[model samples]
Target chain A: MSPLSLTHRDTVAGPVLLVAGELDFVHAAELRRQVEGLVLHAGQCLVLDLSGVEFCDSTGITALLAARQHALAAEAEIVLAAVPAHLERILTIVGLVQVFTLRATAEDT
Target chain B: MGCARRVPADLNASPGPTTGPGLRSAPGAGDAGAPVGETWRHAPYPVLVADRRGVLTGLNEAARQYLPRAARGDRLRDLAPSWLAEAHHRLAEARSPGGGDVPAGHLGDRFFEAHPTPAGDGRVVWWLIDRTDALQAETALHSARTRSEMLSGIASTLLSTLNVPRCMEVTASLAAQHLAEGAVLIAPPQGRRHQLTYAARGTGAVQVTQQVDTRSVPGLAEALQGFPPVPARWLNPDDIPDWLIPEGFTGPVGSVIVTPLPGHGVPAGALVLLRSGTEKAFTEGEEAFARLFAARAGAALSAARLYAEQSAITATLMRELLPPKLGSVHGVEYAGNYRAATDQERIGGDFYDVHPGSDPSRETLVVLGDVAGKGLDAAVLTGKIRNTLQALLPLADDHQRVLSLLNGALLSSHQTRFATLVLASVRRGDEGVHLRLTSGGHLPPLIIRADGTVEEAPTHGTLVGALPQVRARTIETVLAPGEICLLYTDGITEARGGPLGEELFGEERLRRALAGCAGMPAEAVVEHVQMLAFQWLRSGGHDDMAVVAIGAARSGGPPTVAGAKDGMNL
Candidate 1:
């Protein structure tokens, strides 16, 4: 039920976006817009720190995939840092556990 | 009717009491206090005595004060108001009083009705009585009547329809013909564009939509935003933008009024009225009346807008949310039922469709799914998913490939939604019936045997549309006569109800219900399952629940099973 908030921070891993709150139908497009607006050079890594994701639905899953697609099109690497436990189970249920690079924490990226 | 040229007797009657004869040089030698003819000299009302030649002979003290220019021997034309002098000439020539309106005119700032009485020596005594207050009262009464009639007409005409465009048209026309020489109605801007309905006196309104700079007109942008309008006097007529002028209107604007149309809670729109330079400038009273009119129009327009919006949503619901009817396919009986989450929530994420194959030999495809979210958005996506599945019927035998293709289609589209789907391909032959069931993150279908036991198919996969790939395992099973295979969405098991109104109608309850319906017909099986789930949630919680049962009709001969059931929940 929490509203979504996104914050961008430049890190050694390149650009890291801290995403908090529910990533459902209403807020998924906002997340996609934020990701698409980022300038990712080749070989740079874009990390999504989802440590605060409260609720993730199928639309939220699609948004994550769209972000990954955007990064790949820029020839940049994408990673999910600090994935919430429920979101991890969701990713596994959709057979997407092996698709993206995962890190234990944003600092690990 | 009285002759127009006749002067009525009342016009001849002296406006005041005639000089009392008793006062004229003592009627009985000692009864009078004034001398002979002194009453004419001291009449209380203005009295002018003019001869047939239109030359003033004498005047009373009141006349001197009322007509300051009058001299003892001056001509009536040079001393008195022209209307009075003209009346004196006309009345002096007539011997008897005629029948017609009396002459009236303005003398300085005061209004008067002049009465005449015959005097000796071919002269007329003119009495001027002030009637300024009476005339003003009558005029005000007439203007008030006219305004009330117009307001009532506006009310009836505005309430006549719920069509927004028609209402706007009427608003523009009424304001143009009644309130001003021309009118321009600006609807609330949608995005950066504005819709304008323009009307001129004696012309039908025309509508145009374009991006307009609201700031071009003074007080326009604020008025459009529901702010109170600035006084019309503050507006400079020359500053009006070209777009503001009604088409074909070829007159200079004398005055302009921009006012907000107050609606329910929010402003409906803004109204602009234009007056030609030849016409009188708008008055403060007129501006206040315009606001009253704008209020009525605003209420009606907003109501119409709301009605339009609601109907559009309903149309979408009717076209896409209603589940399709299921019937017998080939030799198998197919029946399905759907229920929305609540009365207000007529549509939710749950949806299902059964597509009969091109031929009797080909398997009929049944797809059931639940999209993310609920209501209108989810129902819309459900429609797309069903369409995609129908297009991939040729690949029904390969459930994994069908899901992957659908995934690609959904991902490529602009919708940010995904769905879980279970596809069932059915083929009937000399054997009872064959069904290949596949689950794409949807719960596996439950099979009912003639022996009254329920077995869950060993099939599961990732949901379609959201993931980069789809992986599913398809299980083949055969239904021996009078056996049913039930496919349903999560709404059935996820319904929160029972004692505390928080308990879920879980899978165990569903499996038990199916076992009780073993050996039943397809229609009966689905009805029984749905009825139980619906009853369990009678305490209140519900979601969009759907159940599709594909059953093989019982035969006269012994049943031949194509293969034994492969999966079991136990």
Candidate 2:
């Protein structure tokens, strides 16, 4: 798996986490740690841009869920942006599609 | 060898035959008043000649620069340094025999060798050769050689063993003997207390565990942490507390050198050298040498610690992660095997167990699962799930209800990880082996019929833990005599290896492989699948693979599906 890289860029709405590379077991925890450090407001929505993700495993999905948990704990909303087809299939299969707010692209919402 | 042969010759040549050992021979009228040659007058060293009355006769340019106050015909006692003057007086008074030893003395921070030659008529000429720089160099060279030897000794001794306590003992004793009169080695704090090893010069090391206050000593806590791990400090002797001083160590403290024993990753420990009041103070060079010793000790100690930790992990995983041995239960043949992604890894996310029922009529519950993630974290979760599932054995009759309870248990836990598992209730019937299989987001079992046809058990469900509930639909199937049904993890189908080592051993390949082993025994079938998967993996990157098989015995049984019971003709 390719090593994961993360970039946090703040937009007018909120911080958009630009996650890249393979989000497998090796790097899933890193994403959670990065999300935990974010400063989110009550009304602002946090976007996880997964456009550059080469792969995602079950642990990667858990990390995404943990990111959601972190955002909700801060009274903020989290959205998965530009979700890949494979990741989209897993999110639906695990019933996370109902739990998370999903968008076609980062600029959609 | 050459020096040994030449020493005696040199000694014989030193004593003059005409001049006795006396300070001067009786005055000879035939000898010149001052018969010294021109070479002696312009010598690089200081030289002087005097009569028995102790008057100067001749001196060289360097001697003129060295003894500016002494003029021609001056008495040697008043001008020359006292050590030289005293030697001259002793030689005169003792008379008649000499040629014993050259007198060495200091001259204004410089050392000199005074060689006295007897001249005619009770006169003596003395030569002074400045040997200050040569002596200093010899001393420095000796110490440097000694320190290097000690460093190599420390390396060989400390690195030979992997035992932590033994390494500490050796380090303490070596420092005490070489660096100072006593030494104390303090290992990094474990929990709260630290393990201390103390040794005094000429004594064996002693080990003691004490709750040491690290902040009491300056630079000690930092050294233990290896923040800037290489500095060696010679702290104030008074600053060394009673706790730091070893038991039975007497005399007032004079010098203390503290050095950090840096390790591969973490700091191994710290070394403290103590010298008594009478002992010489530690030089700057000695302090640096102590740091080098500390490095060797640290590397050995840290290697031992890493080995210990690795073995502990290996043992723990071997016991916790290995699947239970499967065999015939209630006349149904059962077998299961597991392989981790890599040989070095003894444990992973895959886990399975076979629990026998109270009676043959009661189906034995079998479990196989793949926990989310990998490595220690996932294995830990797998263990918790297994324990929880064991606690819910009474509810094994209903797979859907068991899945719901497990999902609830996992959801309440702190970890965000999840798992997918397959549960099969196995029972032997008059017709064949009956199985009620349920899949909770795991792949369903593929049944190998008597006709060598592979069929998937009609079971589908969502993964456990992520959702609030598990909505698995349990499906019933009967394995005819000599028929086998297999439950496996995705690790097999997802493994990538081929001629190019980039192909997946997918579901279709798995079905074809199982179809070939349609009538084989449970053990053979599991091994066959494992063999094919390994061949596909072929040193390629893979995940944890596991397979469990349940087969109906063909002995005295009828073939109920697709035939004439000729499936096992081979």
Candidate 3:
């Protein structure tokens, strides 16, 4: 069980949250809290950078959906940047790929 | 003249000795019928008599010491350069018939109250009294009130949430905003040490520990010892540990207050508050307030830690209760899924397993059963039954004998628990896949023919576990290529709640559901039935559901039985 590490930075676009390690049940709530604290305005974007993510589970997927919902509620945009291949497969299987914007890197967003 | 004294030509002459409470009289001036002029000259308070022209006419000993440069006839403007202009304006107001006492004013650092009284012959008396001590007391009272209000705010914010990480986040945010310029909460090491540093941002706080050291910091060690808040001031950069400094933090931290957060029996962690250059050091009052805040945070952390531990334990047990993955078996397509009726923390008694036989016949044994109860008790019984069946798998050829042995084992245990289970033995020969099923008070298996026909397999037996001896009969059938069989728990057929809101998803309804699933793969067959059952039970209650579907290999497909082994002694 690899421990999760979260780091965040503010950019002209909005806030970008970087997640690493295994994003599973144990550390899903922490990511949720960090994302929930973000204050977004219309036309701003919140990007989740997951290039370093080693693994993700159903709970992790749920947290990502929650982040999307929060951004939508705030009338803002959300993008998943650098998502690992395995997580993308799961997202596609669960039919959530259509609901989120994907980018190859944070710079791309 | 009738006057007791005349004005002296030389005003600088020393005149009087103090000899009264309000007025000090000169040594000989205390005599009976002493002149009123001598008494007024030695008054204890500063007294200045200015004529209607605002010129100083007379002043006592106290006035000379307090003002230092005034002569009897000097103008008020020449003596007190800073205050005389304001005094002249105030004097004009005082001479008015309706004028009141002047408000207090500062003379240098000291405060004073000025009282003016009208006198005859164009002379006015002014008295000045010091008020420095009273002003100091008022300022101190106001500061104490502000500190306490901040303490209350910190307490309410820390105690508002019970989540452990959120509690720590709030603590860091509030401490940084109200108590210090930078704050870090060092949680008790979880596998490895890490710090959560929150620095004050515009209206919120940001986490800044991207590359922190995992080792315990110096102050944190002392804090974990359970001492009170320890204040460190004028600390050199070397004195501060590497873990406490956030990556890219450029500000110099001059001081810090580190306090222990005591949990149920031990300290949960430590909270470190940092201040930069020129910020006032932590006062005793603030340290007391920090302790109050940490106490509330400690309780919330302890509760959350305990909950996490219990959840971990439940997850471990559930993993144990879950049936092993149903791997591919020879000549059959196997798929199954189970959903517990309760939350994730609980284990349901609904279980199923497929064990291939060890003999040359290559027969495979499949079992699906539900214990009589729910929760831990049922789970324990299910484990026992599964273990016993694993030991009895060598007898797979004699289905009735294996069940009779299971029945005897349960009765001999003297336990009140019972179970309903279906046991099937499957083998492949030149004809097709052969299946023999035996039911011990369990539901009959549903067989779907390749031609879209669905019907219950003809198998029936007595219930197990209550009687000393039991009898069960076996029904054998051959599934041609593309045909499938499904065995399920009562949770499916007995489920209630449909369009009518009170009807059971009876066996007839299950048959109707399978009618449309012909020629489908085994996995899709199980999914279709499970989905229909779920839809029927929507808006109502359900029990645990478990299903296992076995299909014969298609005719043209390569044989799935090559090198296949037997019985997974589960």
Query: Candidate 3: lDDT over CA atoms?
Result: 0.70
Best candidate, TM-score-wise?
3
TM-score, every prediction: 0.51, 0.56, 0.60
Cα RMSD for candidates in order: 15.4, 13.0, 24.1
Weakest lDDT window of 10 consecutive positions for candidate 3 chain B: B1-10
Which tens-of-lDDT digit does each residue in B1-570 have in candidate 3?
A: 011112123311324332111221333222423222445576677777776677888888877777777787787766744353355545555654223334356655566555454454545556655546655665667777876787677767766666667777787777777777777777776544354646542334444334454234556676765666566445675677765754434477777777888888888778887776567777776767667767766777777777777878877876778876764566567788787766653467788888865542678899998776566767877888898999998887888888889989987883435577899888766676789998876778899998889978777665566445556678999888878889998778757789987676877889888888888878888889899999999877567788899888675432443355443311
The alpha-carbon interface RMSD of model 2 comes to: 2.8
Report the Cα lDDT for residue B18, model 3.
Answer: 26
Write out the backbone clash pairs for model 1.
Answer: B7-B98
Question: What is the TM-score (0 to 1) of candidate 3?
Answer: 0.60
**lDDT tens readout by residue for model 2, B143-208:** 889888878988899888878899899999888888888899999998999999999888899999
Cα misplacement distance, residue B160 of candidate 1 (Å)? 6.9
How close to the true structure is residue B197 of candidate 1, measured as C-alpha lDDT? 95
Point out the worst 10-residue segment of candidate 2 chain B by lDDT: B1-10
DockQ of 3: 0.01
True contacts kept of each: 0.40, 0.35, 0.00
Instruction: Point out where model 2 deviates above 4 Å.
Output: A1-109, B1-133, B165-310, B328-330, B358-361, B414-416, B553-570
